[model samples]
Target: MIEARRLHILRAVADHGTVTSAAAALYLTPSAVSQQLSALEQETGHRLVERSARGVRLTPAGEILLSHTHVVLAQLERAEAELAAYSSGASGTVTVTSFATGIGLVVAPALAVLADTAAGIRVRVRDAEGDASLPMVLDRQTDIAVAVEYRGAPGADDPRLTRVPLYAEPFDAVLPLAHPLAAAPRVPLSDLSGDTWIGPFPGNPCHDVVVLACEHAGFQPTLEHLSDDFRAVVALASAGVGVALVPRSALRGMDLTDVVVRPVDGIAPTRRVFAAVRCGAEEHPLIRPVLDALGKVAG
Candidate 1:
């Protein structure tokens, strides 16, 4: 029977155009290279190489064997990589970029839960606002990206990405302890005309949504502060810096001592959260668990 080792040596000889060159390249003595090729030829019952003026040339059979060897080597490498990834807690690390609320309220919590459950899973998180996260994900800087968009604000341009709608949460106007609106179960848009507003600054999805919602509410807001940090936004809302528009998911189980979230009246402001991955790698073994974990946490 022909051995894979012998086949590999023959392929090297075919590639290098001479047994001496192949032997040197493989760190094998010329004699060993010749012996392996000789054994391979004998096992196959065929003449695989012919002497040339300079060195040697592969016969038709040798050419075919060389081609098969490449296929076999590639298959073997893929198998090894797959097994290693599976054994090492899906060993490849997933670098994730997340929107503020998603990081604090969703991804961070899920990763903590996964650490306790999945031994082979590893995660790296980055604070990426919605606008920058998409390009980072498409450029492969981040393995997964969590972002926010209005129902149709993602635009019509579809790049090479796999988008999953994780969840959508209603937007609420957050009030401070002394605000008169704090006593109302939910504030209507008509009541927001004269109030100061807290918003994520420029280029933030929440900021954009806050702008659009206010326009729909018959008045543009007087922006008091622009904050991308959800913790800071919460602190501002708690300090009565200004009333902020917040996603329900951000407050779902969080404790806000001085802040109250009331549904905005007349306009049901909602932000759609999405998770994106590289198109081809969306099915990678490490990706499914993380996506499933998001679903679990979002639920």
Candidate 2:
């Protein structure tokens, strides 16, 4: 069966005339968008697109599929609009799971907004890591999960859940105050290649983030000390043992006494945070308001 999500991707390519442009509009990598288009072609057993030096154009098969894609997407939107109206007066609880920083940064403030403006909605917040929270949403343990992009996260086209992007935060380099480059306005990640590293353990999501960041800087980090808690990581750096890459959000609660924070030179590694709900629940009246509130504060 053809996935509706792929149809949307097809429509994006058709409208934009190139894979790169479509990927940008969809907030996806160009490679990911191409993979989806390829899967779409395989499912239909026809070549859907013709790529050339200038850009891309649809083949006859692609044209036919795109024509129907419009009708299908329109119907889906209509269905969502009607459902929104049906649940217009909805009043109930929205249970949410998020990491500690997420709870402090967005969730709690959003709850305050709901108390005043969305009296019909009541939100219950729980502290859960992003990896654990995603499964909780799938198992129906929570209505929503504030999650970070991770190694095994559900793809954008996953049918069981709806992904709403929240924001992306960068990882900053933390070094001992007495380190040679500690006072530099922005530290090159590669500059710390020779330094011992302090970071989260292997299974933690932050661990993958740190590893990826270091790899992007052209070298692997030598994790001399390990701690998942950002505070502990910073404390280790402050103790002048090693350096670490900590997310900007996690650093908010740190005591920074003998440590210096610097942005990574060139591009910093970033993690994308998003909200996930069971498929079709995003439009629910009560849940929609909370998502809106979250967006407002996340801004």
Candidate 3:
């Protein structure tokens, strides 16, 4: 019989498209991954992969096995979830991943509540961005991921995962105290058409949001400064270098001495944050309580 663990390794390899990448995802060495793949081939009596200079390609046999692998793994996940539900108490560790601001706004508070109420459940947290967090959950790297609605994120009805809506937060304009619009009750995105913008790097989800927001307002921002850290973005605005738009949660516990924040007047740019878990494991006893805690905190 083929081992379930070997099938898992194969699925990882197939998903990642390289032995090295699969090994990194599984926290194993490439040599270990190769050995497991070899063992799996021997057990199945089929040449599963064709290795080439570029990368390994799945053979017909490998493709056939991969189809079965998904079903087997999902069934196993369902079995584990059911078993956990029937267990006397929720006493296992639940790993979670979230972006920086969500960590402060949601995960941290949820963790605090879990510690006080569900003492038996141990929680491990990893800081990952929205783009990476949901994939981490799909890869079984984390039990839950706090993610945001970003360009290229998986849809809400993605079959492999279950998404739970958390919060919808608007991005506020940050400007220097000395700026002309600093005292305005609200700032329009078009008003900053000529202002030098400080924003996240181009590929970042937040950067995409800012760009889309600006496009909707009929102008493209002249991004003079790039930063992933929202606090630093606000600080740059305060220094009179450039203006920025930052999420509300990012300002928590920050000192905004010379920076003024105001909502956008017409089209408010907002991000929706949510939680994702493996589709079949959402009802796991330990996971359910953590989800509850997160919902309470978000509420």
Highest TM-score among the candidates is held by which one?
3
Go through the candidates in order and give each one's C-alpha lDDT.
0.76, 0.85, 0.89
What tens-digit string does per-residue lDDT give for candidate 3 at 78-117?
8898887777558979999999889888899998999898
Error of 1 at 201 (Å): 0.2
Question: lDDT tens digits, residues 1-299, model 2?
Answer: 89989988887787668899878767789999999999999999999999999889999999899888856765674576467668675677889999887888899998998888898888999998888788677545688899888887777887557888888999999999999998899999888999999998886777889898889889999998998778889988999999999989989967897899999899888878999886666777767888888888888
**1-299, model 1: which lDDT tens digit per residue?**
66868866776676568888878767789999888888888999989999787988999988787777756654543565466556753755778898767897779888977787675778999998877787566444687888888433344244345677788878888888888889898798667778887777877788878788888878989987877766677788899878888877767666689888788876588888888875545556677678778878877
Give residue 201's lDDT in candidate 1 (0 to 100): 82
Candidate 2 has its poorest 10 consecutive residues by lDDT at 73-82
Which 10-residue span in candidate 1 carries the lowest summed lDDT?
Answer: 151-160
* Candidate 3: 10-residue stretch with minimal lDDT: 153-162
Candidates in order, TM-scores: namely 0.62, 0.70, 0.85
Give the root-mean-square deviation of each candidate in angstroms: 15.5, 10.0, 2.8
True-vs-predicted CA distance for residue 39, candidate 3, Å: 5.8
Shift in Å, residue 16, candidate 2:
38
